[model samples]
Target: MKIIFNRLYADYLMPSRLGEYEAILRQARDLGYAQLAVRDFYRSRDRSPPGRVLVHRHDIDSDLRTARKLFALESRHGVRATYYFRLCTLDIGFMREIEAAGSEASYHYEEVATFAKQWRIRTPDTLRARFPEIRQQFARNFDSIAERLGCPLATVASHGDFANRKLNVINHELLNDTALRQQCGIECEAYDDALLRHIDIYISDRKHPVYYRPASPFDALGRDRAILFLTHPVQWETNWIDNTRCNARRIIEELAWRTSASC
Candidate 1:
């Protein structure tokens, strides 16, 4: 019953979210908020002038086409945002286009958590036992992706893989070790402590009706606030039919996760 309701909500109620996404971006621009990507915001967190700032980030979990559209829209509105791509969405051409738009393209990492799921490291002690191997893969993949992008990624956002819930581990947990961060050339994680400390408000479009759960971005405009926004391109739809298909896929994936995790 809940699954059916969720599918209806995603496929029907949220089809106009893409427009809402643009509306907020445009509103911020008009209100004199300086929009910056994740990398730039983090690098200059201390020296930011006293004003309204919006730090926008997009995680491309699926639907590269939608992500590209979102990128172009942001570029049109003179908004710079960081785009984090999973392994499937990392296209050199699109990433270069994003760079051309003056936005940051980085990695959305899930390798370590996947390793845990594959090895069935269901407990903290077992996960720690295989930490070496898992960490090695994380670094290797990060390096490999950086080499492919032809530049160092300033921040990597950990992916919340369904496998993570079954394994009792988070992908970014490995970033706790400062040494690992240095070895991988990661300047910061998406949820860095410093970022959380500095930002006055954090908003994410990962959930339903994101603009209003706590409050709307419009309400925060004109105030001196540091706002961090995380959006998944797949969640907002340009086509109703396509969005229905996407929602169906997610529903299937959710059911599969629930079933597999139970075993």
Candidate 2:
């Protein structure tokens, strides 16, 4: 019966609306989870507090408008979260607005894939040969984003490009290099295992549902365990149909932009 209900909720009830998210936040509070912006979690590492912790993270894949809405919703509940924006989607105004609303902002980078596509470097050999150049470009892009934000970005989340089969590089790999971390001044990765050490559970609304293989937040609540919830701003629509339509529109827009750029 519980499994049936979870499936139904995943299919019909989730990729929740703002109101649903608000209710979830309230429930987390009631369950004794303290909300922390990613930066706050790092700062409190030495003086660990009692009770569970919830680190809310948003990957702003597209649509700054919707991201702003999520930030406002979190603000209304007096909860803070981290927002990571892609270089192609950076909006200084929106970043500043969310920052003012008490959310932390950082980069969502896809430098390796971008470099691969730009150079048409498909093979592993080609990618290996151009590794240094790719790293240089990554640093430059990071600097550009940080300069625009007018502050150093402490954390970054890798943006995955599954469509790029030629360059199968994961963006987070850049952080694995100690020199790159020191040079870029990145204090943490959004999905770093080091950070996960403090978290007892992790949940996400990936692919438009509360993905449950191992477990979901619904399963972990009231267990006195720290949780990390990752969500994409594009998923939290009023309903599944609307979310699908919005995503379709974004794909069309992206295709049109690429076509126009090529011409």
Candidate 3:
């Protein structure tokens, strides 16, 4: 089977990093990654994806000015991407611009219960006791966001919810939940694919490359088709300098050791 590389991405851009992001996008385009998946960028509202981490805030602003700048850059490239909107932080003018520029948009939601837990506002045990109700509320909130976006959303990805978690968080459940899938009209299933192993793919923790995960987006009934990639836009702006150096060192050390053993 020929392995095809695809990138599904999201980015939470901090206000200060707009210029850096421009450079990163330029590099991706030069390297042939013309398209990307995104959650929130420069939208500094709370519950938004934190810089270099999955943490959320109660009052982060949605850096709209910066977002507009990036949007303009994408326009010049003649490339389109999926931008998941946090319904609670929806800015009508911004949403209109996204549509005007021909970019695909969707919803970005965090299960309220999960958000509380992630922030240590509630313990996991407490969340488990109330998961059913929590999931319903979460889905409903997402539905509301979709309504404002106007079209039956084309695709969806989590805001601060990472797909690689071990538990049935909202994003994880949405990967295969028929009900949620039908509600959101999300075509691509979001799961922890093997290629996500390069830790450098994340901005917050560039000292390590992503370790591979075994789950496939498709069920056991596998097919040969295009593999979808998801990456964070703000995460891409972070550097992976240490990880790259470590990898190079390991490679050279392994080669030398192998030669010595042979002699």
Rate residue 145 of model 1 by lDDT. Answer: 82
lDDT of all the models against the reference? 0.77, 0.73, 0.42
Please give the TM-score that candidate 3 achieves against the real structure: 0.51
- lDDT by residue (138-207, candidate 2, tens digit) is 8898898888888888888888874244345676765678898899898888778768788887777744
Give TM-scores for every candidate, taking all chains together and pairing residue i with residue i: 0.86, 0.80, 0.51
lDDT of 1 by residue, 1-263 (tens): 87667656765675656777888888888888889998888888888544888999899877787887888789888889999998867897888778777889998988766665565444666776777787888888889888887878889899887667756677888788888888877887988887778888887764453434355667766664788877887667644665666567667766654555421
Native-structure RMSD, model 3? 16.2
For TM-score, candidate 1 versus 2, the one ahead is 1
Task: For candidate 3, write residues 1-263 as lDDT tens digits.
Answer: 11111111122121244455455455545544424333222122233332232211111113334445556766776655555555545676666667767665655555642444443432345445555665677667766766766766554545553212323344444344566667556554323332233112322211112311232212111231222333333333322343244346547644543344221
Best by lDDT: 1
Comparing 1 and 3 on lDDT, the stronger one: 1
Q: Model 2: which ten-residue window has the lowest total lDDT? A: 254-263
